[model samples]
Target: MTATIHRLGRDQAPSLEPMMALVAEDMNSVNAVILDRMQSRIPLIPELAGHLIAGGGKRMRPMLTLASARLLDYSGTRHHKLSAAVEFIHTATLLHDDVVDGSGLRRGRKTANIIWGNSASVLVGDFLFSRSFELMVEDGSLKVLKILSNASAVIAEGEVNQLTAQRRIDTDEEQYLEIIGAKTAALFAAACRIAAVVAERDEKQEQALDAYGRNLGIAFQLVDDALDYESDGATMGKDAGDDFRDGKVTLPVILAYARGSADDRAFWKAAISGHRISDEDLTHATGLLRSTGAIADTLARARHYGQRAIDALGMFGNGKAKAALIEAVEFAIARAY
Candidate 1:
């Protein structure tokens, strides 16, 4: 079979700055809430949390919450707290993930676990998780509480599911989708749906936004998976080939393993079987991904999900927020470039 290489042209992919600009004012409010809620009398609590929070991520999840609220013309303060809560939940997951993965870098900086030790990182993660619940309670809406709280639980389940799939060469597309959906996309769905809920919108609108966020999150993770093979560490904000080293069975690996030649399959099976992966092994793995169209196929799946995310916004009327949300889908897929 011939490989179909996917190339990202410069003009085709727009920057994420516009999405951030569209919701700039609201994101500012979300940031304020994040800083305020992260504070505590104990210096270490704030210190550890701030370390990761300050290590600038795109803040995509919280921005989705803000933009989703704006899409529905929600003129309330409650979404602010909820957005911060979403961010806290995301950050808590990152802390725990670093510990689980034994990762030393995040967002191009030292991971909290590396700087503060695994014990502090784990404890701080728990603190942030509790802090997220506190924000939910402060919102005083049982419905909103249910959505976000359920998302947190789903995120945990996804992580465990991925752990179960780790280093297993036989992991397939369905299992990979389940892992990303639970680990990453669940919160995205909740973040967007809660906006419609706060606005007192009907169930249809809530479901639409939920669909949008869920598909976008899936696309986002697919791109990350591909980027692990294709990107330099600078672009990915983590070590290049981190997934290969960790024996994580992401979509790229699944597709490559399924399509590879006999020798190629053997190489992959050994590389990801929890053995010591040399630099040369990673180089060969990347070559197979490129030559077998795994990266392209993975990116095609991302674009598929991105289009679904855009389609989910059809119920909403035309406005800057709506347009920006659509562009956000483009940005999510384009990030791999």
Candidate 2:
């Protein structure tokens, strides 16, 4: 609760330059293919999918798909299909997450649940989830299907576990990692893994990509948690202190509480456990995080994961694509709101 959101000024993070270039290189064709594949058997399905698809996400997942494939020297067009598949899976989860969390806003706009209702959001999410499977099966690659299915299952199970464990002060970093891995990292892993799989990469290269994605996902979510404390809804596209408001425990607050003075720790116990965070108390908590360096420590951990993600690609040879992937690791941690 002590974490203060940090919004970036006009200076954009330099790390994104290479990744942005890669995105521009292939984004148009990739998006075209993705849009073409979104045609649904059910009319409402397309509408629901369209609502989420048009919401203007970073398209980070699909970009990773293309980048990975290109890095492995895949000149074929099948990567576009796999990229769309990865996007569908990601969008499906967002729909379901909004519904489960009862969140009203995402990315500074009304959530699907707010516009279409939870029932619609949940059902449409199911539709998208099924559609992703159908698309992958059409590709007729057993490896792709297996990897994506496993990721899907883990994402669902992770959300369920997080729901059950909400607001528990005792949640450790291990438990935190497990929950985020399933909920966030699984698709990142799958997206990267599928690229190597489709390219028929060697085992060592495949493993490297997997490690990169897994560590990148962890770093991404950790930074996400940090931003929740420091960013406003307009900038971050979500409510500030959303985790705290939802009675969820995240890293900054966890670290702060662990290192706080008796009274500072008691404030968290009372505010979180007894449900007593007021506007006044929120200001006090932010100050505590600044004073205690909990935010800095959590950011340091995210930096470590970010570096690991870059290091995972050391085995790969030189190329703009590989450099872009490496730059993405830095971008993941350094993004400002």
Candidate 3:
């Protein structure tokens, strides 16, 4: 796939509303299942879980599940509950991630970890994982169970892999892809793939959906990493320099460091080693990223993956579902700007 990017302002760019509209009614059913399953006699269960659940997240993963099913022209209501399962898994991961990263803000609001504490966040994450498994079990498709369960395992492995690579400036592009493919793309693949199983489609169709979600997931993450430095706190919903302050060696840093002068390399080594993290340091880092063409190149890579995602849908016929899915790819790439 040729990665051609057409830059557009937020107002004129592709929107997610089309996809959301296509699945709006189905999402309501999924939301009902999510609300019902999150409840517990303990009371704290729903409170903490709901905190993030009700947060301003776009519910993209679950929406992918519903949209993929719609692309197959699924007639039954089975995708709704399964979509909730996908969401629970996603929310659980976010909770655990905030604690691991010691994050303070998400979607312009205080994180559950910050409000509820580390142990509470971790336990609630586990509870959500349990709820996801229960929903998967009720679906009674062994293939679906295996797909989602394996994704859960893969995500754990990816988290561990990222932890080891953290603050290590030597982490390469290939390894970074592997880490994100597991942590972020695995569930995305499963979320779309299961729709094929429920819709009783063949393996070819299932593989196509998996590819669509996987490529889109990678594109989504690359854009997020680029925005960590380029976007403001209000635009990003997290601190603008969170990755820099936390000593996370994302793609921008990796590329900048690789292409830097001796002094610039020293600066990067110091920055990723938990030093040089003041506001001015972040400013300097952003300048280095621009000078090295790292930010621009990172966005270019995202467009590559986004194009692959759009290409993965070529087998599907032209229709509202296909159009919305294609525009979703456009939106993901557009977010970096």
Candidate 4:
């Protein structure tokens, strides 16, 4: 049987800005901490970090940290520092990822590596990683430190796993899910879990928040993978078919490849095997993804995870924060549209 695929519309998903407004006050504090911590005696450190930090990308991860904290009514200053740490970790990953992926653009601007060379990008990424650890240490919570620290390690492992799986057509859906979970979702889970820890909420609450983040992260990455094939440079902040050009086996490719005919499989095997891929190849691949319902199926999978993210919020009381958090899931899924 063929899979039923669902497509998202422009008005179908909720906006993230309203959800962000729900924690506008706390997010201001988090932003303050972020700017204050990015400073350095070495001119290049701040210059390079600031270039990316000020690039107008949505600060979603740190927003999650602050929103999670506020959801439990934690009126403490420590969450500020934790949220900044989350941003640092996220920024560091972007720096390193650009280098690893040889990306030239991010947030519709030149990537750090493209401007400053690979060494500078990599070192700056290291600097951000160290800064994140320092913030965790300053927070004085062993549990928070452990959660964020483990997330950092798991993210690295996920990067390596993705590297190992690169260009391999045999990469399965389960393996792809594992890679995204560790690389993207681990930090989301940590960010949400730390909020509960700081609030001194029960283990059940902590786990619930973690589950929400984990599922939300999966949905977010799935949409991102789909967008790489569907969006233009203006909308997606990068060129379309980047994943295909880079030989990265994202879910859209996986689903399409799995469901394709013999001739279709051969086409994918050649296109994804790191050969010289032309624009025409990408156009053809997009057609195949559409014809085989890969893009729609991928979005369907994102919706599934998005619903799980919403369900995970059932433990929280009904309020602006809870409603905003649920809407945030829809926003994450709607980016593709």
Per candidate, the number of residue pairs that clash is 0, 6, 0, 0
Error of 3 at 290 (Å): 0.7
TM-score of 4: 0.96
Model 2 per-residue lDDT tens digits across residues 1-337: 3532222222655476687687575767778866777776777777777877887788888888888887888877777777788898999899989988889888788888888788888888877777778888888899899989999999999999888768777777888889988999888978898889889988788788888898899989998988877778888988887777676777888888888999988887776663756767767777777788877877888888877887788777777888788778777777633
**For residues 273-322, could you state the per-residue lDDT of candidate 3 as single tens digits?**
98899999999999999999999999998989888888888788778998
lDDT of 3 at 154: 97
> Which residue pairs does candidate 4 place in steric collision?
none
Task: Give per-residue CA lDDT, model 1, range 254-311, as digits (tens).
Answer: 9999999999889889999956499888898999999989999999999999888988
Report the Cα lDDT for residue 3, model 3. Answer: 45
Top candidate by lDDT: 3
Q: Supply the TM-score for candidate 3.
A: 0.96
Task: Candidate 2: give the clashing pairs.
Answer: 4-230, 5-229, 5-230, 5-231, 6-230, 108-237
TM-score of each predicted structure versus truth: 0.96, 0.92, 0.96, 0.96
State the lDDT of candidate 4 residue by residue for 1-337, as single tens digits: 5543223334555898777788788888888888999999988889999999999978888888788887898888899999999999999999999999999989999999999999999999999999999999999999999999999999999999999999999999999999999999999989889999999999999999999999999999999999999999999988778899999999999999999999999999998997748998999999999999999999999999988888888768777888778878888988777
Candidate 4 overall Cα lDDT vs. reference? Answer: 0.90
lDDT of each: 0.90, 0.80, 0.91, 0.90
